[model samples]
Target: MTLLAFLGVALLVVLAGSRVAFYGDALAEKRGWGRTWVGLILVAATTSLPELITGSSAAFQGLVDIAVGDVLGSTLFNLFILSLLDAVSGRVPLLGRLHPGHALALGFSLLFLALQGAALWWGGPLLGPVSWYAPAAFFLYLLAARLTFLYEKRRSLGQEERLARLYEHLEAAQVVRGYLLWGGLVVAGASFLPSLAERLAEETGLGAGFVGTAFVGAVTSLPEVVVTLSAARLGAFDLAAGNLLGSNTLLC
Candidate 1:
């Protein structure tokens, strides 16, 4: 029954998360923010909210193992999903269509991971609530975002008037409606994760890290899988790739 409940809740998350792609795509078109920006930050962040919630809640409850495991496991699992997306992409190669800005994101992500690893290896000092890695990661994330913004700006030159018109015609009301409706559902579904993961860990006699990496990790990431596959099905390759890559990068 517990396992079934886990599956049921995971399904809800997927359903709620899948709709994010549709609304995100529409917002990108209406705002002319382009797929890179929407997929990397907006849609990715929204879909990844479950992890944010799960991690924070687990930490608050003193389940540091689960919190750390979920982040690491989800990052790897998200990358694995990219391979699955490639398989189902039909004639077009999914990775071939991605923007070059993703390289910067990947680089920054690796650098952050390396910092965490170094801290772990050498036992780096803490900064109150977290280790030194925390603030460092934030700074690197900011730099990554800035670099991406500049890259997009350079690539989209001379389209200011068109972008202005796109902005003028933006469907603010409907977009907010969609985000609120789906976003609420996502939050509701995600809220169940911490307790469920704890129960599952206890029932299975697995370490929190192992269970978090295997079960909770996959469960929370179902949203990304659903959204990415849905985007791929519709030939929204950039959005699809960006969502996965961005989610993976942010997982650190």
Candidate 2:
């Protein structure tokens, strides 16, 4: 029953999450936003909702290790999705097709990962109860976003115009509505994951860290897997790559 419940909720996340990328693409087209930027900030955030909600739930339940493991494991899984994207893309190299701006996102992800590792090693409260790295990660993420925005803006002029519009029929309002609706569904489905994961860990007699990293993390990352593969299939390599790399940075 536990495994079945987990798979069912995961399926819900996948269905709702897949629509999020399309809506996000449409919203970007309507707003003249860069696809990479949209993939990074908008689509990636929606797809990563499971990780955020599950981690928060785990933390609130005093499963601190699970929370940390989920974040780290999710980030790792997001990166692995890139290889899957490459496999499905065919002929052309996936990395070769991506925008140069993705390097910036990759660097930030590494920095964030390093920071997380250091925090875990140096454990303790910096701001009363909050870890010192929390504020640092938040500020660094802001800085990464700022730089990415500027980079995308500079290169996006002629670049975006060449891509075909998949959602030309949808109005801006409609796109926003669809994105919000699906995003809410993703949130609803993800909220149940942590408790299910905890129960699974107990029943299976697996260590919390192992269950969190392997089982919980993989389930939470289903959205990313779906979004990246869908984007790749649509010939939106930048969006595909951005979603994976951006998700890693965001998980930090």
Winner by lDDT: 2
Q: What is the per-residue lDDT of model 1 for residues 53-157, given as tens digits with 9 covering 90 to 100?
A: 888878899998778777877888887888888787777676676667677766776887788779778877877867887787778777777776667665554
Provide the RMSD of all predictions against the true structure, rounded to 1 decimal: 3.8, 2.8
Model 2 pairs whose backbones collide: none
lDDT of each: 0.73, 0.79
Per-residue error (Å), model 1, residue 246:
2.1
Please write out the lDDT profile of model 2 over residues 1-252, one tens digit for every residue: 998997898788778877876777676677776667788877788778878888887899999987887788788777777878878888888888888989988898899999888888987678987989989999998898888878877765455565434566677898899989987887788777666866777778773555444765676777788778777777777788888888888888
True-structure RMSD for candidate 1: 3.8
Off by over 4 Å in 1: 1-8, 155-170, 197-213
Q: Which candidate comes out best when scored by TM-score?
A: 2
RMSD to native, candidate 2: 2.8
Model 2 residue 100 CA deviation in Å: 0.8
